[model samples]
Target: MRIQVFAILKDFFKKEFELNAKLYTIADLRTHLSLLNPNATPVLNRCRFAVQDEFVTDEYTLTGNEHIVIIPPSSGG
Candidate 1:
């Protein structure tokens, strides 16, 4: 599955990238990413994952996706 990095993550990852991880759920993806990019781990927990344009929770299993979007933390007043 292709994981899409966005916002601050692009900075942490030094540009978007993808992984061929055999992950089952969003949590699994996070774990994989942490190992792949420890520098982003600290803020990863606050990020969001989306598949098929719908935001999914940690437990949300990944069935299929051309690309998964990882939205970083957003701030606003």
Candidate 2:
């Protein structure tokens, strides 16, 4: 699966990364990602995840062609 990142998530990764993983759910993706950057766990826990733009729960099933996006809450003055 190809997952994208924005805001805090983008900052955490700094650049796009690909992993040959067998994840099939949002929770699984989180587990896998946490291994790469343990410090991101907390932020990821509060982040909103999307499948091609539609927000979904952690149990949401992931597909091969789907692109996931993880974004943190945005604030403005």
TM-scores across all candidates? Answer: 0.83, 0.83
lDDT of 1 by residue, 1-77 (tens): 77678778886774556677688889998888899879889879899888879998999988655478888887757
Total clashes in model 1, counting residue pairs 3 or more apart in sequence or in different chains: 0
Each prediction's RMSD to truth? 1.8, 1.6
Cα lDDT listed for each candidate: 0.81, 0.79
Per lDDT, the best of the predicted structures is 1
Per-residue lDDT tens digits of candidate 2, residues 1-77?
66777776776785555556888888888888888889888888888888766899999987756777787877767
lDDT score, candidate 1: 0.81
- Model 2 local distance difference test score: 0.79
lDDT of 1 at 43: 78
Candidate 2 RMSD computed on C-alpha atoms after optimal superposition onto the true structure: 1.6
